[model samples]
Target: MGAPDYFVILAEMRTGSNFLEESLDAAPGLKCWGEAFNPHFVGAAGRREMAGIDIAARNADPLRLLAAIRERTDGVAGFRLFHDHDPRILEHCLADPRCAKVILRRNPLDSFVSLQIARRTGQWRLGAKGTARMAKIRFEPADFAAYLDMQAAAAAAVTRRLQISGQSAFHIDYDALGDVEILNGLCRFLGARGPITAASSRTRVQNPAPVSQKVENPEEMAAALAELSAQEPFGAGRSRSLEPDRGARVPTYLVAASCPLLFVPLPGGPRARIRGWMEALSPGGAPPLQGMTQKSLRRWRRTNPGHRSFAVLRHPAARAHAVFVERILYPGPHCDMDLRESLRSHHGVPLPEGPPEPNFGLDAHRAAFLAFLAVLRGSLQGQTGLRVPPEWATQSALLQGTAQVLLPDRLLREDMLAQELDAMARPFGRQASVPPARTGAEATLSRIHDPALEEAVRSAYQRDYMMFGFEDWRPEAAG
Candidate 1:
């Protein structure tokens, strides 16, 4: 009944975080709020009042608000923190001895699948809802790999923070959630007294069966899962150390540039075929930036001075649509759950009333897409927190900083990829035939045919329109 000590539930998506937190909250003299620092969570009026602050103050000075919540709580006070939460709050929480840390983990494969199911069904937690929605997700190796790598990175980051602060944390696993002993152990870790029993988890496991039952590519996923489980020293797979640098732009097959062709890669652009043509120019060699270093990057820059450098650009509306369908609407690891959360939390998009149909209604998808664009617009205007998926980020923003320093000589339109490739080739007296540009077959610009959504897209990517000479985009519905 005094000033309460604090504790955080460090977790990732679909890691039984809700279950763990609910169980912990049920204990006497302990309370763990859900992702208090999450943009969406913070903006909720109910959550704000619970924290004893208004939404504006919470956003303006979250650290103070976080501290206030801890001070105001009746007993042990804490909140859930994801890898993508506000950094300032996470830093303060780790640095404060009054704040205990509980790190939660789950089988990466299971977690990834659960996340996809929840996203597809819009049923994040349990209810009297008669049955769980079953979704058949076509598992792609790349998507799985990316998901594993991302989750691993988030865990490693928290470990690094703990190490820097010389702090130790109580670790819990998703598999241990239902056990009364495990629940009690968590309570004890939070300085609770007396015997505590596990509470019924507020959520249900969406998929309780083998991975093969839900996923199309179960064999590959199983092999990858085995490899991941066998990993020792943890968080070791592909070396993504370079991911922060140049936005994952390691030169592909386009290393040998006859004309100082500095091909700045754009995610979700025509990078694949462009690189393929570069590979055609020369095969059976290590691609550019394959083993690149900071020094090597500088060397390439120095080596390519006075050469023709270019990047391909896609219409912002088209790129956003493609990213939404291919990444967001799909059931896979690459789905941008964080972005979706931000849209709901910060942008005021209403939560869906029911589980999403496997093939979502076109109007529903369009509204969601509009919400995403709204968040992106905020990010473009220097809003922070939610890490915008690079694939859907405005080209103008992605090309800033080091990429900006490399100054592109030309920006090729995606629709004219073939024409642009031939032009670059003609300058060198070599004809390079390239494949046609790729678009989202499942969804297109027409998805957001509403005038309002189209306006949002235009506002979000205004810079792209002005810089790339894309005619002002109006929704087909408007016309």
Candidate 2:
């Protein structure tokens, strides 16, 4: 039998990629390199060594390493690429006609649960000398929502990439990965003889029990999962372009606009907490400003507007990075997914399909961040204008053009959140429980060391830097 050129296992973590890779490797005349772009261990890592080159030298340059591996492999050479792997390699594989693409999908809910369990126990693969720790993992509804959205966006991205590139791919779901026919079909697709026997998988399923047993909040999990299933594709049936309708309800917490007593949740801002506190304080509950207009804003001003307005200023780069993490990187099924979908539809930028794993390097993330910034820049320049979700919009734009447009009587720094809360609370005759904001920005920034991306972020948020006096701020400060 003649060997085919090459193939790519386009998949995500905990999505039965190990099983698929091992099964393919078992086939004669087929060489499967596992995670060739993995930053720490290049060229199949612990499983098989490349002929002679030092992997560490090639690790930094994925393109060189892939070329070296392809040259060295004697058979039909292929490599497994998770969504979070080095994007340069992924793009190269996608663009090359010699490479056959195999897109693997899975039930994201199950995969997410499995990943969570594994993360807690520190047991990612099978046969490792580790016992199952029966600790119940705390369930954050926002986190679960983000994971669901991210998985959906990733799956959609794979389809979109294939369609746009016009690449003929062998699509298989994780549930069908163990099937004999599927395995043999993959071999045939690679131009190899079938009847390939299955190999024992190195990765084990962490959660053997039902989903209910693993999570601390079973009801919440079940509800969230159900809601996720019931939802439509990330941005399906919605307008492809970023056109915020005239009658679109602007989400705001009303206190006053003239005296400027209200707080506007600028995407990724602390508007939610402010709104929640307002509802608790008001006798009628947070006022229904559904049809909020200039008229309504004026009325609010006339009634209670009296030197109560204050705005917290988050660092522009930090806010942009936070938006990328929440909306593009770990988006929920609703708004975050919508923004990602719009980016894909309008700018052809696809969010990574893989969940943010601890071991995955920053190359792919930097690519995503750049893409996200590009879309954001476009949105700002486009007809949609400042009518974007707070995450992508400039802080200056959100505040309606810096101090010149809508100057706050009192401007407080987001880093000094406790003081801001205390000041706001004193006016309402209640002490604020200022919970330290749980932004993962510092941890995320640590992995990023690319000068190009750093400059790109700095340039993209230049307005925020200029207006908010953060021009001197560097990523090192966050780290």
Candidate 1 to truth, TM: 0.45
Over 423-467, each residue of candidate 1 has an lDDT whose tens digit, in order, gives 876765556567544534323565556667667777777656666
Per-residue lDDT over 326-381 for candidate 2, one digit per residue giving the tens place of the 0 to 100 score: 66777565336665666656555655444567754577677777777755654443
Instruction: State in Å the error of residue 129, model 2.
Output: 9.4
> What's model 2's overall lDDT?
0.61
- Where is the poorest 10-residue window by lDDT in model 1? 236-245
For TM-score, the strongest prediction is 1
